[model samples]
Target: MDQPEGLTAVGEEQKVCRLQRSIYGLKQASQSWNTHFDEVIRGYNFIKNDYDPCIYKKISGSSVAYLVLYVDDILLIGNDVKMLADIKAWLSTQFSMKDMGEASYILGTKIYRDRSRRMLGLTQSSYIKKVLKRFKMALKTRSHSHEAWD
Candidate 1:
């Protein structure tokens, strides 16, 4: 999220439009988008977290649903099993949303959570395998280091 070109308000007393490809951040784009999404979700009865603006919560009697937004990515949590599906439907009506369930691989790391054992794990085993195969080292001896060039 490096500063975008001409991103500063620059005391123009007005706003300007941007017409360039940015590094995932479009200056006020994130905030405006977030505000828009927050309004939509709140209209659907979800409450935005004051402490953590990225988190939105909804409570219905004993049931609760939580939403976490990271830029364009959203991870939802809820005690009700159908909450995710319901939210997905609602969000789809407002904006395009793709539900990535269970979060297996992100940024080359596979995430696993053991609910009964109360543990979580992040491993690059699949990533490493892909890297190995990419280098045509399928049968090469394994060394647990990326700095090994020889």
Candidate 2:
């Protein structure tokens, strides 16, 4: 805080400048942001997950919703559509955010859902391909054998 570059202080050089607001790039900045997020989410009646602090869950009557936080990214999932919409609207009003509509990809994994069958799938095919290409192994093909090896 000792007088930022190009800004000259008339007084002692040893005196550090006081910060008017929470400054970014500082260690406490992230902590403060996370703490504020936790407080806000808790105010919405969402409880933090025990195993992972970044996860929060809210259950209202028969509806259940979950919120996952990864850095600045968020992934929300819920059984009740109305509950999900309400939560999204509330969050948008509180913070500057852009809704990506339905979630298709998250954390390098692609999501597939079949509502009628009630099946959900997570795939990393694209990620695996990229990794393989980076290592020059993308050209390799898997060998298929109908005969059993004895």
Candidate 3:
């Protein structure tokens, strides 16, 4: 690897820097992170999903938990609250992370939940609004009425 611009020494300009560890934004960083994460999570008996490599699931008797990984962010879902808390605590010990409480939004999608109805909904209204604003169409309105074809 070529020496970084500002850190290059006058006499050692031809010397290349060797990386000791994976650095963020590097091409191998994500792969390294995923490999390390997989090993740690698997140690806790979590099974990586066959369909999606980023998803892991742990089942113990009646308690079940699902962990979804998106880059550096993680979204945890489960029926048992206690199990989820345990997983969060374990994750905190394993890596530096902050609990953002319940997930309201992720990846431009909004999450809505109704405990009373036991319903969950996902929407992209925020994304749509951003796109409309980007093209200067935020205030534009279109007629929805339709007339019989001649």
Candidate 4:
């Protein structure tokens, strides 16, 4: 690659610099990041899902954990709390990531969990509301004109 402006040496102007790492926003950045992440996660004994390349799972005896990847966002889910914490710690050492605690929302979907009942629910109500508002159909009251159809 050509030398960037303001970084060209006085006598080494003709010398091209080699990239030591992938730069963000480049065309190959996404692929480069995915490759690196896969290598690191696989080293930790995570197996990539055959059906979905973005999902990985790791199991040890009765403990199991899953890691979901989307672009730069990641969601870690599993039944074992200690395994999850270990994965999070390992990932932090591999990349700069902030722990958002328990996940409540992902991809515009709200997550509801009832640990006592072992129930989990997902809703896209917020996304649906946004779409309705965009199309100017988010009415506060039912219109009398549409009552016949109801």
Candidate 5:
């Protein structure tokens, strides 16, 4: 297929995504997905955040919902999960997605969410511990919220 101006033709983009735009430096590929995702969800009453439009919100009474996407991976957070599910289904129908429900790992960190408490937490404890052990810092017997390192 002939390559789109902003996108590399198939078999051309092998990890070296084309240089297309710049904020301070090159960063443009996300524009298409962001535009499409925003257009589709907004059609379903999902309003993209004004300050950070990439962050979308859907509200109904006491139910505040969220659907966030980075490139193709989606992370949903909400009190009324059913609405989120519906949003996901709608997005899938429009975008042809691979939905991996419930985020556990992202950006090299493990996420643990307790629905009952509605608390979200992220940690690289295993990773840090491995590093410390590699440098023999694990023997120090000091355990803090990873803040100790910082």
Candidate 6:
């Protein structure tokens, strides 16, 4: 932590301070947090996905579970309910985790599932609208929206 303004001893003005551990406000803190999370999650026998380091998976017998992380939030999914619950409980013990129940959205995409058909879908319609609105280019009609594609 740098000395607070007006509180630093006269000679200390030229000196910089170093932190022993990363914290939220530091520039490198997010990297440190991700590294720590990876270590802890890997310790639970999960393997980090090669394509996406933020994703981890665990397998036991025929059951497979996935842990998707976006910063501090997590999305836990699996075919076995008991196994998912166990992983959630274990994660709570390792960190200050909160169970957010089932995930409905991720990365501004809506998630849809049909258990009977074993199908899953993701949509970003709402996200697109938000982006359009932010840029003051939101179309007033579906026709206008489609015309932009041409």
Between candidates 1 and 2, name the one with more favorable TM-score.
2
Q: Write the per-residue lDDT of candidate 6 for residues 1-150, one digit (tens) a residue.
A: 787787878867977667665443778878988999999999999999999999999999999999989988999988899999999999999998778788898889999999899899999999999999999999776786567788
Question: Where does candidate 1 have its weakest 10-residue lDDT segment?
Answer: 12-21
Candidate 4 global CA lDDT score: 0.94
For each candidate in the order shown, give its overall lDDT on alpha carbons.
0.80, 0.89, 0.93, 0.94, 0.75, 0.89
Pairs of residues at least 3 apart in sequence or in different chains that clash in candidate 5: none
TM-score of each: 0.57, 0.77, 0.77, 0.78, 0.61, 0.73
Ranking by lDDT: 4, 3, 6, 2, 1, 5
Residue 28 lDDT, candidate 3, scale 0-100:
82
- Candidate 4 residue lDDT tens string, 13-36: 999988766452687888988999
Residue pairs clashing, model 4 = none
Highest lDDT against the true fold, candidate:
4
Candidate 5 displacement at residue 26 in angstroms: 12
Error of 4 at 7 (Å): 14
Deviation of model 1 at 111, angstroms: 3.6
Candidate 3 local lDDT, 7-102, one digit each (tens):
999899999988766453677888988999999999999999999999999998999999999988999999999999999999999999999999
RMSD of every candidate to native, in Å, equals 10.4, 4.8, 4.7, 4.1, 8.8, 5.1
